[model samples]
Target chain A: MSDSIPDVKKVGALLLEIGGLLMSSGASSERIRITTNRIAEAFGYSCDLLITHRALMISVNSNNSNEFFSSLKRTSPHGVNFTVVSGISKMSWKIVEENWSIELIKEEMARLKSISAYPRWLTLVLVGLAGSAFCFLFGGAGLEMAVTFTATVAGLYVRQESHKLKFNPYLNVFFGSVTASMISGLLSKFDWGTNPETAFATSVLFLIPGVPLINSFTDLMDGNIMNGVIRGFNGLMIALAIALGMLVSLMIYQM
Target chain B: MEDAVLILEKGFWFAAAAIGFAALFNVPRRVLWVVGLLGALGGITKTLLITQHQSVIVASLAGSILIGILSVIAAHGKHAPPLIFSIPAVIPMVPGAYMYRMMLGFINLTATLNSENYAQLLYDTLHNALNAVFILMALALGVSAPMLVTRKESVKNLKLKRN
Candidate 1:
């Protein structure tokens, strides 16, 4: 019976290690929050920690917190591997184990992983396009504006997500505006099948509220001032981009 | 008469499209209808408010402030996305089409022989564009006023948190 107990313990530890690896690999901002929250609640512990490379490092400020440490040990396995990344040691498995749990932590993390899913980007695109189409129909634009506005905004939104770039707030605003200006200018020069107003509206649709103006306002209202300022700057850049595009088109017309 | 109605209908649908787009994006549905009404009203009233010989800036300011006041009441009531719900209504007042018209008119008049007579038309166009810009700025300021005032204390509070 004594011999069998050690073997059972080893196997259980192995399973927990593998699960932690999988959860950390899929970490997103929301998942990270839930994972950390679960760990704190499960162990009756509260600590500030960062998870990196599929491992968690928790900071505890009490001497008798060793009991809490053992709980983490049961939850986390892989025996607390440590590395000097982010100019901080004691920030990986070593901090968790030499300090906290291995098993319970893993179980809570698995829950977070189960709940995590990517946002549905396509649904947002269809919604925006539908709005643009409606605008084209009612606003004094011909068929040309509705079709183009829908296509452009949808395409921009889709392409942006696919790239997975650290979204530069100003770039999209400027680019969307410039692109709209170009299309509008081309349509105006040709005096095409539809009126100029339709063409202008269609091109500018993509440049609209996708910039998060209202959300920024809400953030400000909620007293998240920095976030509000950041989003506001982003919105301003977008408007400037539109103005730049208009300026360029004006210059071209003058020439 | 029929032509005018058709134009109005098209404008109505365009406004509806914007409202529909807002809905699809999960903007509060109650607010969307109000935004549509405000947009259409802004468009129609703007045309009526334009007198042949008037101060363009004054006209735009009055219109923008008027719309801004209405938007705040509606937005606060619905607890909707303020700028998203209000900005579109201002779209109908955007001077894009009018500015284009002015530029085109300038080009056509200049290209024609009666250059001196075309000055009045060119001046009118410039006035309209300037008025549009002024109005747009006012609209932006006015619509954002409620949020800005509410945010001041919150912003100050955030500074304390960051430190």
Candidate 2:
């Protein structure tokens, strides 16, 4: 281990980088605070972090001296990537155990950032299958599951395309639901399945904002009420967007 | 015997759904199967409890707590955090049907404020909304309780050992 402490400014920047990554990647507030603090402690410094929906502020103080540094970094828009969250957790442990230098930490962070998501086609198809599973679990028969599979795939495609076009996240959800429900609403119109309503309902199950809802509750439980409320409100807004989309489709089908 | 078979089938679909969502969330490939297993366990537990005539809220709570405990244990073996497994696993239990009904009734209520069935619509909407909210809270609290109890001490120990 290096006898001298790392420069406080660099450490503060690194800590802010870690905090921003975790915050944007759907981590609970507690996890962000803990993971960054763990990395800072490993470098013989103490970290205090103030996390909000829009930005992260971190202060790092050297244990050996009066040196201190603090900085703020604006987080990017939120997204879900469990791989990044877990990767950083593992990296923090390695930093403490292997005594990773800041350079090595930077390299590992770059590697993590570059990790590719699953292929777009694969994700869409599998998510479609998941929607079918939900339909079946909800008592939909084979034909209903098949219809749900189609609707979910189409809806997710629209969501992905809109997301790529830099549309608002909630707008993307609204578009996805509109597409999915419109497709399934046709099943009800044609009277093809034993329970067409089940298919219609479960088809949009793919867009339920599961991460934010779960994370909001965890944040609240950990006493981070401000972040918890923000996340909860975010989840509720996405859900409302979904409902409005479904309502439009329902009106079209006149159901 | 038939009931057991039905539960197994439900569990299978639940596992499949969980794995698909896990992939969408970009869960690490190494632990995808673990997520599937945890999902199946939670779903089967809820199904079994419901068969025994338990309320949906209680059953959901039991299932999510099981997932939470198992995820903590699984994290040790896989070298990943519990949330990666628990979040995707608990997702299959979301009260989608209730939420859908609530939203549908809400829309109808707004459109028919003076209709004869307005009171019925209002009651149904409130009922479904409350059920959905409670079940969601149960799932979240159950999955997070174990981690909240264990994480602080674990991190503290790591820091102490190093110092």
Say which candidate scores most in lDDT. Answer: 2
Candidate 2: DockQ?
A: 0.75
How does each model score on lDDT? 0.46, 0.90
The TM-score measured for candidate 1 stands at 0.46
Most accurate candidate by DockQ:
2
Worst 10-residue stretch by lDDT in candidate 2 chain B?
Answer: B153-162
For model 2, the superposed segments whose C-alpha errors exceed 4 Å read B149-163
lDDT of 1 at A4: 17
Give the per-residue lDDT of model 1 (tens digit) for A137-199: 435354565545554554455435533564454554555555555655565567665565466
* Chain A TM-score by candidate, in order: 0.47, 0.97
Q: How many Å off is the CA of B33 in candidate 1?
A: 2.1
Q: Across residues A7-121, which tens digit of lDDT does each residue of candidate 2 receive?
A: 8999899889988988888888988998998899999999999999879988888888999997889999988988889999999999999999899999998888878568888
